[model samples]
Target: MTAPIFPLSAVVGMDDLRLALVLNAVSPAIGGVLVRGEKGTAKSTAVRALAAVLPAVEVVSGCRFSCDPADIDPDCPDGPHDFAGPRESRPARLVELPVGASEDRLVGALDIERALAEGVKAYEPGLLAAAHRGLLYVDEVNLLGDHLVDLLLDAAALGMSYVEREGVSIRHRSRFLLVGTMNPEEGELRPQLLDRFGLTVEVAAPREVDARAEVVRRRLSFDADPTSFAAGFSAAESELASRILTARELLAQVALPDAVLRQIASVCASFEVDGLRADIVIARTAVAHTAWEGRSVVDGDDVRMAARLALPHRRRRNPFDAPGLDEEQLDNALDDHSNDDDPHDDGPGGAPAPQDSPAPADSSSPTDSGSAPERPMPAPGESFAAPTDTFRTRRLEVPGVGSGAAGRRSRAKTDVGRVTGSSRPTGKAGRLHLVSTMIAAAPQQKARGRTSAGLILRRQDLRLARREGRESNLVLFVVDASGSMAARSRMGAVKGAVLSLLLDAYQRRDKVGLVTFRGDSAELALPPTSSVDTAAARLTVLRTGGRTPLAAGLLRAREVLRVERLRDPRRRALMVVVTDGRATRRGGGDLEDAYRTAALLAAEGTAAVVVDCESGPVRLGLAGKLAMALGGPAVRLEELAADTLAASVRTFTGAA
Candidate 1:
């Protein structure tokens, strides 16, 4: 028997999340809600409980596709239903889409043999069909394959699934309430996917002792005896459900006034979100909010409430950014939107905005609050400097292919992505190349005296599809914070470069570690982990000073990678060293020691990059020499930018 779900009414805190869920339920036209929070935050619990408060759906009895009795879908696979057939009422289902789900499992598939041989179309319904007219929940949504996510978003946007495979085509209504829950620390979803979500909210565990205690109390009680625990909250659940039903009925009658319409436009414009989707979502959510409040019209308050839920994901620029709107920023946008129109959208004929300002920070955390502290003067080997404005760095990928976690860098052998070719199964292949297997078996079939039933397939004839996809690497950053370069701008630029790389790692699903060498010693500032946010935090407060220990840094990086490889042998490592180059003499670590260490790394075939932080017209090209030893590329600071990268980035056989 399935365990009873914890009641939505029993959830202790998360007012924003609860409200967002209710609003989406009230108006699925709001698109869908993406809930982002840390683990143990009840994100999943709240989503599952949503089914309890949802009104039961009535469908044509015996219809496999869950077709509505009154509005039967003509295109439904199980169609041609009798209008006079018995009807059945059932609670809305909550179908789950697993992270590892394949395209065939999502949009349905065809029986290949029947379609190819018998010239018959046999369609097997997938999760999209199962979720029709119900709720579809995806857990660990960020970890889901990019292609699967695209398919999901496409179906959700179109409100239908068109599955055509092996000459068999099937189409059906797939409208549902898409509720996805993700822990930001695991990884980030693509920007394209983020924008598709109608509303986004960030939740954290309740800070209040009493609220936390209540959460534990209720959870324990439910675990002890789910039946009795759920029964106790039955009345409250029903009342909430009834309210939702009433809200749904009243939603069509709610008025969205011109003032509110303009307000929605103004808020989206002020936030400067890309595309018109945000505006539309805000408008829809505003109407839902009005109904939830038992009100007739969307007022200014309702508009703000809608923006609060709808604008977060739209404005996000990076993975580490906390997913929510700053109350002050939102108010300022709404209060001054009349004149605040795009800070850059001005001048006669919409003249180009001024281009002289230093670029916005790529390293700074958007969510960090409180004023920074004053930095004390550096002693022998340490200095404090704010990060320089980060730029769009060049793509620093590990050369060749690898078998690792799915990512956007370095070629990988994966199940997803386009089929590159076919290869015989080495051990257990990723995906089977049906056509290739048939081709390999065709000639042998006649030799084996095949009958008319079908071509006999032998175990040795199996062919697995070879696919080339990108895999995330373990990015180990070796930063030089020695006294040789301690100026704020110099160190800041170097710090900014590291910060920029960290952002890339976060987006590419790479685990990262930081190693800083100064004052005759190298220290592991941060260990390799999926949480890039933590690495960013450590970088923001990083202090630099002391003699440069270039050799020590390389040695430490090798050690870190060695340990990481043991834990996860499949994941590859890419070492990124940030420095002006050349080990300091009259004493720091020996330049020869550094070179030898670099050579060792190169011998190991470790993909590496040497970011030459050297500034000014006059230079020794010491960093280039170091890059040569590492057998990677030597990219200068100016050359690291997206615009200048292609022209100036040089591949170093051994040059730093």
Candidate 2:
């Protein structure tokens, strides 16, 4: 493998993101940080860099689970008694969950040979087992299959997986830090899964020209000499690792005062955030911030810093709402609660601050004393102060779309059909057919047929049938290879998602096509071909930069379908458009014309699914409108994974 490049010290401009990583490093209980950003936003680079700086954890030698021999609990099967000698130790592991991994490969399965040969049930370990006490990173997490995601969440929450398959009843501890990265353009992760994340930070491409240039320069240098480049940053990497270790040690002593608790609650209330997630995350993050700063006590500044990372994704009343704790409103609330002589006050250190003393400007104030100040007391009637705003805007209900019930029903139906077909074999069974056996036996009997021995089919003669469904699916991927997409890092994510989908299609023996539109033209890079490798190779070479010519791309895709339709009507055809919905050109005109053209093409017998790849606060624009016009689904790009593609294919074709 290539040596890891891009040390953690090289990351710049994303202080909030870095803080989230630091917090998670200090306390894994704080949960994983969700970094939402466009494509070129250094999200993966930062993550890899952080991984390099992480302290190497000691794990059991020869154990795929990376079990801590010293920390082994009663549930551990391979206890000290089972080992021949003292267990060995090794460095921490960073395991990547590839998109195409199977269920058996992920959660483990029965040892088939052991079961069949010796009639002994033996358990085999999987990726989860291998990732124990390490980092289990999943890129494009939102697009992961719902089943796989559920399994991951269950394992992460319970810290174990119980396997009760093939007469084996095995429960193994499989605890690991779940680090997931996604580009929001593909699709959104389910809310239940999203809640599991402790901190969320939105990453954007380098805004300054100098930063972008520097990124390119560094990347090129590393590519030219991976070993030397990594060696150059060794000192910086060591320093980061040391800092993280210090933070982890300091996390336990970081104290949260009642004042900070009140601030956290007030901020959540001000934002009208639903549930207790915001409050909980804010508190944990605050503690982590204090620990990171080498402080023994959490202060107002710690709470303030935590708010930025914890509050954004938690206040989900409006999914599209801008993130952060509403700094202006939060500052005002703090000012209002800063009064002295309040009986309810408990500022930093638990005890009441002197009523006559001025408030500290920073968390580290009273430096000469070398100790945190006493918690302040709340004034009379101040403890029960009502919020200025009782209610903010309710969560936006996208018209005509039922929130949970309808969606669940649709998804359930889709899953049922997909599972049934996926489980069935496509070719002939190995044994003799039942009908053939009956016919062969009939010929051996006399004309009377009943005079002979009663007809009996032996187990050796029994044959199981296989169900074969329509083989090919015409999948046309309409990619928005526009400049804006390239700027936000959406292009890389889109490419990844497309590659994942193509891999799925290839496995299913489906045909796929690639059509990318940018600048003044749309190009059909690859026709509908069963060779997914060829299509994927062409896709990887696709660079994003130009105006969006969505109309032309759709028209070309439609024409390709027109030809394919003549060959087979049973074969499913789908047009997947990946874009941020910003259809514009270099001539300084709105993309309204292109949008209309796309809509018209989509209406012409093409089953369409639009993936909004845009990130940040930008409006989704014409994508949603066009999806509606096409009478198809509009999903965020981050949500577009292998399962999503399969579900879309089934939905559009009404196929089993």
Candidate 3:
């Protein structure tokens, strides 16, 4: 028996998420929804439930591609003649594209061997075909491979698929409501892919006691008796489905007035959004909203709602910056262009509305810390300092090929990356490199003395694709915030350096944690997280002063990393220690204690880099010695600067 889906009408809160899904159903051209939220936030539940409420679709009987009887695809791989074909109505289908699914499974595969030997044009259908005129949902979309994402967005945008892999080319209509649910904590979709989404909604579990309780109550009831719970909401579900159908029909009648158009164009301009895509999306969404509300004309209110859904993902300046629309600016634009019909207004589509590192952690590389000289241990004090500025930094990478999380740092082998070559499969052949397999199979065709004239491919000929792509690493920053290095200007620069490193981490998609040593002990300033914004928040509020207990800081970081490895053992790590390398203690052995802790990290082969903050004609060189102890290089802060990087490299090379 088919499992009952949680009724869409029964879902609580998440008003924006529900509306976004409805809007797309009303008009697929409005594009799809990118639902962002934490796990258990009903991101997937809402999507799956929507399939239940969606109006049933009518397709030509016996059509695997789900062709609309009114307009059959002439180029469909499974086609001949059209209008007279039997038609049937069924509930709209929801197709899922799993993260580990291969390319052959997504776009369907062609029987190359059959064609070469038997002269047959046999083709197999894939998920894109199955999802035709229905809905396609990709859960955990952020974790989906970049190459797969490109394919999804392309099919969504073009409304068709042109499968040209393995020498078999086929075309078919594939218009579906593309919905993706992602947890930002995993990582993020590239901005280019993000902008392709027409609407974006951020969701979270209800915080109110009553609201959360209601959610749990409904969930428990459904889990215990899905059919009974669905039956209870049958009336509400029927009403929503009827409303969606009516909205779909009403969409064509809704008018987009000149003034509403002006508001959309104006709002997009004010936000400085990069392209006219946002404007187009808002216009379509506003029209859909007007129809959805049982109205005939698009109005300012409709535009406002549309802008709320369409502009957040488009206006983000950086991934770390949360997605938001400045309502004040939005209102100003609407008011500013409320009454205007200037042909020279640079109207929509007239022009572009928009606007729009690896570094090694090794000690020899120039890295973290300020340029200030060592100062006396004065009275411990605290201050919250903002980052001085941000600039592009050289890429810092861990020294080996890794098989870690998707990131832009150190290179690793991944199924979706560029194929360097091919290898014989050791286990189950997951990513079969077809051409290589065919090449190996060719020699055996004649040697086996096969009765058949075709190429004789066998299991022994299977080859897996060997691809190379970059992987994200765990970057733990250990900073010295003790009194000995706590001059106001010096500490600010040190924090600035740390902040800069944080930005680098953000860009590289590295999970980052911060450890600060001062006073009597060290604290985990921020736990390692995919969210760089959180780390930066903690960094800005950090205080300086107190005796440096460097050992404690390294120890804390080691503990955090240990826990993290147990959580995700695939991720490699890079330790960045920002210090002047001074450890003062009332009980003594401070420096020795610090060294011993560093040795433990070195023993684990943790990639390390110490940014020597000490500067003067005379130096203690403690930071360099610490770097040596950690089995990494130590470089001055200025060396982290991009412009001076080449000069530093030349200096090191000349010395060598």
Candidate 4:
């Protein structure tokens, strides 16, 4: 059955997600967006909505490659098809990556039937070929096979795919906008691979009650009448297309100001972000933002908006430290630089003096002013410069009773309560002293006319040993229940993967928990428990829908861990996220807010592993991007199921 089309404007709350789609539509150079959130966060809806409204592209007919006739480069090896007069027409394509697809299916393979029947080698085009001059979307991208990921990455980077197998070498253009969605609960993406994405935004469930209601309302309405629902928003979709075209034209003339460039740098620097990728992304994103606003010059607001998207994914200095710049720090830096000089003030040399002002208040502080008297205002001609204060540092203190102290107290309390006159068992078997038993027997013998005195009790005569059992580790399964996961058969594959993992968890005797996020909520399906049967059953019935609520899921998983009693006796907590990495529902495309949620979970010391389920033509999506943002390990399901799952789990549990 064909899927119903979703309206673009009806998608609730992710302005950044919408903007990212619009910008990319206008200028693919602005790069792709990474939507990070938990399940049901509407990640897939926005992407599909985008596809529904995407402008049609003119391509050469009968050309499976979707080659643009007008923009054909001189290097075209196809050798200039006749286009001097009339040309055939073709519509833009939107290709989806299926979960169970193989390398041969995705990157084209040797024509087996042709080789056997005709004795000739031929290469069959794959999804990449079909997606040329269109959109290639991978839902749950993090779970994609490594070879497949490599293939897509190669094609995306080179704008072409070269397939060589069975004595056939074929090269073709595979340029297309790649969009991938994932849930961080699945796993994470590799850093080397993650750097390919141009922009990343974290999505979340709508915080406002009304927004969430609207989301549900629209979804229900669409489900009730798909055709009418799609038609209802046709006008708005047309308007959106016009706006995108306007933005595309404006993008060419947009100029990023020097001040905005410095502001972008300042934001990145304040975050102690690694590499210069953040700055570059910020600059490019700012230009896109300006274009989205139909402006020719990048403004301060453009830089601010870009910072929210680009800076979040680049702050990798501390993975557990959150995904983006600290707003308080950013605000302080901006204010510091902006108020660095005051023209109205006068200096001793009759020149304007710099303003001497106190630093901005802390985010949690009530206000900058309190009982302290305000500094005296500088005279009209007097220089007023305050010494810059070094940044202050706060230390975290954790209090707990030492093991030795607890043991001593227990021993002391037990000694005081013991019955002094009563005999107790002692020695290897914790049995009565053998010599004492013999002595008592001898006394009984003596009463019957037998006596002995040379026997003495030995240490071996006492018993005091107890067997100890091995400890169990707690494993948290953070599954992505986002709408993208519901697309095609990805959800079925994810369910199969989860079931397989649950079997392993059961064999290992590890406690497991289940968390799912979709729409505007994240729910703990099951808390950490040793009841493997129940947990596995619940997981088997898991369904996917709504947005990717990544942040909420991470936070909830952490909270679940906190309440779980598995942090001692050589046991550690591990988080395994099975997702595609499309966070389209959380924080409404506000990367900073989404990162804040992820950072909180990481800061609590949860060892997170992200499993990318994004199959077919690869797009990193927000899941992998967030994994990089959190500095977590990311692996594909194929990689995990093939080579790493058992080994990685053993290593993590110190069993290897």
Candidate 5:
């Protein structure tokens, strides 16, 4: 027997999540709920419980699409056929979306047999069709592929799927409650997709000992005897189901007061929400909450609850920003709209409105002894002759097929590469290569008795096309932070330049690593990462002092780049060495050693750029010579402003 799902009521804590799910059920017009939390947080448990409590839906008999009898479309074949067929009521289901599901599986495909034998296109509905009028649950939603997420969004937004494949053009209703559960630690959902979810609830593991113990006890009891444990909650489940039915019935009667509407708008505005979706979601949720409570008119409490569900995920502007609403600000906004007659209508419990506290005056004055004296600004640094068109990215070639994942270069079709997939797959093999399939099936076409019409093919004769993708760049910054460079504040200038390059790296989807050389040798400051925050943090506390180990730094960078290349051969490697080429170590042969190491890097196909930080009347131009040895360009320290430096590197690297 299948294991019984934990009852919704049995879920410990996480009142917000329960309410959000309930609100969506009562008013699916509220879209769907997204539960974000770690494992053992009852996220999945609550989602599955929703299926148990959901009332039966009337669907057309024998309709694989689960066609709703009441929503018959005249143009749809199911309309006339299902209308004459028997209609039956079945309990609404929670359809789990598999992670590896393909686009054809999610959306429907052409009937293979009908097309192959009769040469007639017949539509075969997919999982989305079965999910109609039900809850489509996706676990670990953050880990889902980008293409699948886009499809989900489109289906949810349109409430239908329009398929035009294999000479078949059909549209079918695909309305479903899209409930997704994900752990934040695993990965983050795209911002665009996150906003599509009407309600976003964050759950946490039970903190209190009593609650934790209760959860463990209940889980153990259920595991020990699921039948008996589920039997105990049967009556409660029935009552909850009845309650949900009543809430659905009352949903049409739920009213939204003008004040509540205004409050929703105000709260969303205060939070700087991206679009009006939050406002609409909040309003619908408030209506749902009022209906769930068996109330006709919506109140401040309903609005507050709605805001809690709808605004959290939308408030996030950056990747690291936590998903949550500004409660204090929301309360203040709601309080401002409270009725003049009702003075205590601040929130649910007649609490007073939150007010911003006055800012404290500055304690220190310019004349204070404790405060340091301000100095006059120095004159601007001399500007260099910057190239008009300096920024361009090189399109590097590699020996591999592309998976279309981010950071992989998209290129034209080529025969010499790994067999990735066809540019377009729309035949017997699903993604069968048309040219190859036709040629393979040519011999069998005459015996198949379809020669008079045209060339015919069998499934076995199909062949898939392959994609050839180029390599992406990986720029590694090797900075000279020795005592000499630090004394001249060259490190500061280099830091700014590196930051600029990092920004460029982010845009181009290039990977970056930082290696700062000081003291006895060089150390990896920051490992290769796409995160700008990580790079910034590592660079912030980088200290500089001691003799310059130019040769060691070169060797260290070469090893790092070599290892990285081996790990991801699809990445074109580049090293930007920031130094004056002055090797002031005790041995005094470090310059030659560094030049030899640079030549090894060049031989390894690693691009290089040496930024000369030397400042004197008679410059040795050792950095320029080092650049030549590395087979890359040499840039002067004077041309080391963020933009100029970035542009010079881009130009040298041939990056557009």
Candidate 6:
């Protein structure tokens, strides 16, 4: 049995989040709201609670697609026009979006039942249809499929869904509150999709001991006796619902002055936010907030609150940059609007005011009233974070044996066994043109006297499947962390270089693993992962000492790559070894053994790069020799910056 929802009021702290959700609930025209935080932040709980408290929606009775009663379509499958029933009010629904949902399943598809039973073309509304006039909740939305994300963005933007499949083309209203929850650590949404959300809320775990204890207490109480616990908050829930209803009724009457709109645009311009979407979203949310407060007119406070939610994701140039809105700057912008005649205030298209500008105390939270601290500029010749553009458009091409997964490659004969249901004939192996096939078979079914058999099947009807060109690669980083090479600066440089290459690995759609050799033998310091954060965590506190054991590290990397190849032969492996080829294997170590293993790597056709970090006048050139044996080029340690090294490796592997 499903557990009862925890009341929104009982949610401890997260005043910012609660208010954002309430505003969106009051006025979904604010687009949708995104909740970003670490795990266990009650992101999902808050979304569900919003659903539970939402006012009932009046939908056409027996409408399979949940069509609005006021705007019922005449061609609905249930025949609302011919034998329509009275409109009925139903509780607002919470529709969960599955991560692996297909495009057909997300949008509507051709109804197989009606087609097979009655030889009639019909539509089967998907989740998008069911979510009309309701909440479409997506948890871990960042991890959702890319195609699905695109579909959602288009649907949310248009407030209607359009689907063409199996000779059936249909479009229907799909307006809904798109509430998405994501742990920023897991991954990220594309900027295009990110900006689609009208508001974004960042939540943190309760810091106060008392507040944390309260959260645990309420959670335990709810889990132990949900019925009794929910009963306790019933009155509060009902009141909140009524407030939302009143807010909706008052939304149309809420006033946003021309000055307020200018202030909104000026604030976005100050932040250099891209496009005018931020300005529009802020205006809509400000109006929603005004309605929520039972106020007739939007004030500076409403705009500030709206900016807090709408500007974060939109203003950022990169995903990793902190979500920022200098409260002092924003307040000055609002203040400047009051005095548009002042020349100094309009410095360089309204230059940002002094950082020391005082901020008015927020009535909601005293602790959050202070002006936000300015973002620290990076020092000269220093890098803060990797730019997404560096990796976003890059693709890694692995050697292909035949038709395989989806990516960039020449089309080959398709494997019928691997055929997916998608109608888009990717590559050259997919079945005959889907549209043409449907058209060819459409008119002859009735004359053939087998209409009830659901069209016709024959060998000639079978179209050859097309192959999709998808490629994936794995990068294994083998680093030497022996005491001889553990100089703090050397290790730091090595770590930085690896991080740079990892960015390329991410862009190439490749998995990465790290192996470190020190002490007795080599150890797999980090497992294969696509997440840069995961690799960074393992590299930060990596210990460095003991014998080199280059042989053991080489053997370990070879074994790992071998296993990976066995699992998926199509995935190519590239080993980038960061080491100064000095070897002193603990008990059974041998320099010759390492050289032999390097040759074996070459024999196995595994791409390799040996970064020679041996910086001394009296160098033995063992790293150069190792690189030769492995049939890969050696890169000088001094030449191993992120971009340079990534380009060098990509050029070497032909993956650029």
Q: Which candidate leads in TM-score?
A: 1
What would the per-residue lDDT of candidate 6 be over residues 206-230, giving only the tens digit for each residue?
A: 8899999999999999999998999
In order, candidate lDDTs are 0.80, 0.63, 0.81, 0.62, 0.71, 0.73
Q: What would the per-residue lDDT of candidate 4 be over residues 1-656, giving only the tens digit for each residue?
A: 56667887888778888887777777776556666678999898888778766667776655556667786534333436556524565445778887546566787766655643453555778999888777888887765544567788899888888887535578888888778787765544435446666667778898899988988999999999998998888889889988876787778788877766776776666665668877887788788778877778887777777777766666432111224445666666566555546423456787744323333333211112132123455333222222111121111111121111011111111111212232335422332322233444444444455334333334333332221122235678898777767654566556656655554454344567899887677899987765554564565455566777777777777778777734553345667788877666644763455577667767766667678878777676666676665557566755655346545534433432
Error of 6 at 387 (Å): 12
Model 6 C-alpha lDDT versus the unseen true structure: 0.73
lDDT of 6 at 608: 83
Give the C-alpha miss distance for residue 593 in model 6, angstroms: 5.8
Q: Report how far residue 365 has shifted in candidate 1, in Å.
A: 8.0
lDDT of 5 by residue, 55-78 (tens): 899988877778777777555545
Global fold similarity of model 3 (TM-score): 0.83
Q: What's the CA RMSD of model 4 in angstroms?
A: 27.1
The TM-score values for the models, in the order shown, are 0.87, 0.58, 0.83, 0.53, 0.75, 0.72
Error of 2 at 376 (Å): 51
Q: Which stretches of candidate 3 lie over 4 Å from their true place?
A: 58-63, 67-75, 79-90, 111-122, 162-164, 170-173, 185-188, 206-225, 319-329, 339-380, 427-432, 453-459, 586-600, 615-622, 642-656
> Per-residue alpha-carbon lDDT of model 1 for 1-656, expressed as tens digits?
67789999999878888899999889888888899988989899999999889989999988768999898898888888877889999989899999877777888776557644653557878999889888999999989877687789889889988886534578888999999999987877877777878999898998899988989999999999999999999999999999999999999999987766876886776676778999999899989989999999888888889899998787667655555566676776566543445544655688843333223233154224222233456565566887765556555666667879888776778887657899999987477776677778778867899767565778888888777777888999998888777777888777777778888787677899999888778999998988877777677677876677899889999999989989999999989889888586455448999999999999988888888888888999989999899987788876677645433333432112
Cα error, residue 428 of model 4, in Å, equals: 56
By summed lDDT, which 10 consecutive residues of candidate 2 come out lowest?
385-394
What is candidate 3's lDDT per residue for 257-351, written digit by digit as tens?
88678678778877777879999999999999999999999999999999999998886655445456667777767766764456356558787
Native-referenced Cα lDDT, model 1: 0.80
C-alpha-based local distance difference test score of model 4: 0.62
Clash counts for the predictions, in order: 16, 27, 14, 65, 11, 10
| TM-score of candidate 2 versus the correct structure, residues matched by position | 0.58
lDDT of 2 by residue, 30-68 (tens): 778887877878888887666776777766666556667
